[model samples]
Target: MRRESPHAGPLRALFRQFSAFAGVGLVAAVAHYGALIGLVEGAGASPVPATLAGYVLGGVVSYALNRRYAFDSDRPHREATWRFATVAGVGFVLTGLFMGLFNGRLGLPYLPAQVLTTGVVLLWSFSANRFWTFRP
Candidate 1:
């Protein structure tokens, strides 16, 4: 039998972790999007405030699920919460910047712009949280 690459195990583990994180993020996204739509369409709320509310809701879900499931992090609440918040704050800014560049400047449609922004933010969030917030 051929020998396995030295990096294969670590790379596989990282991919598994990323898969778990994405699952948690998908749940959070559904929560965020549902709340956003409800607030904007049902309650006649403006997009900004509704978006903020939805983001906060999603963040809460993300933190709880990620702590227990995604990273299996054992960091105390005080430490992890603040780190996650910092990462998320930066993520929000990145989202806006990406959206501006993709949609405002490039004139792409809203949905496609949001999709691109989401991909960028997903990478940023995963990297930051993996290295900083949930680092062992």
Candidate 2:
């Protein structure tokens, strides 16, 4: 049998990484929406409050997963944590803005607002994660 060099599969490598990211993102998205719905529907919280709670919970999960799995980061330091938190904070603001736009201003349904926020949040997160949190 002919052995193929591991480095010979660029397409496979990209797909593998994309798959890993997507998997992790799916988990985080569930966490985000779950908390949001739980707070708003179950706990009778307002949309903004629910969204805030969701962001906090989802942010924690996202940081943990992105650090350990997505980026395979093992760095331990206040600096790294703060940097990561800063990036997440930026994401939070953007998420909140869109959520508010959809839910409050546009009067869209909760789920629809959440879906819209998800796309924006995902793009923002990928940028921050790639450029800041896990930058080389």
Candidate 3:
């Protein structure tokens, strides 16, 4: 029988965790977009503010789903909630900056700019949640 490499186990586990995280992200993204569209198209809200609200909704969904499904975190709610919120607060700042840059400065449509912002925030959220917030 062949022996497995030590790194292989860790890398595979990381991949699995990331995959689960992405799955949860999809659900959160829906909540984000729904709020975005509803506020922007329905209520005539500005793109930046609309996205800010949507981001909050998405963050709520992300926290709940990611804790139970993606990271399967056992960190007590008191600790985990703060850590998750910290990570999300940073993500929120990033989201606003990117939105301002892409949609406001560059004049990209709101949806497209948001897509780009989401990509950048996704990497940060996954890393922080996996290593800091959810780490056992």
lDDT tens digits, residues 34-113, model 3? 99999999999999889989999999999999999888989999999999999999999999999999999999999999
Per-candidate local distance difference test: 0.82, 0.79, 0.94
| Rank list by TM-score | 3, 1, 2
> Clash pairs of candidate 2?
none
The TM-score between candidate 1 and the true structure equals 0.85
Displacement of the residue 6 alpha carbon in candidate 3, Å: 3.8
lDDT winner: 3
TM-score (all chains, Cα) for each model: 0.85, 0.83, 0.94
Model 2 local distance difference test score: 0.79
Once superposed on the true structure, which residue ranges of model 2 sit more than 4 Å away at CA? Answer: 1-15
TM-score winner between 1 and 3, please give it.
3
Candidate 3's displacement at residue 66, Å, is: 0.7
- Which residue pairs collide, candidate 1? none
lDDT (Cα) of model 1: 0.82
Report the lDDT tens digits of candidate 2 across residue range 1-136: 9998877697676566556766788888788789888888898988877887788788888777777777676566555688878887887888889888999999999889988887887877776776677765
Q: Rank the candidates by lDDT, best first.
A: 3, 1, 2
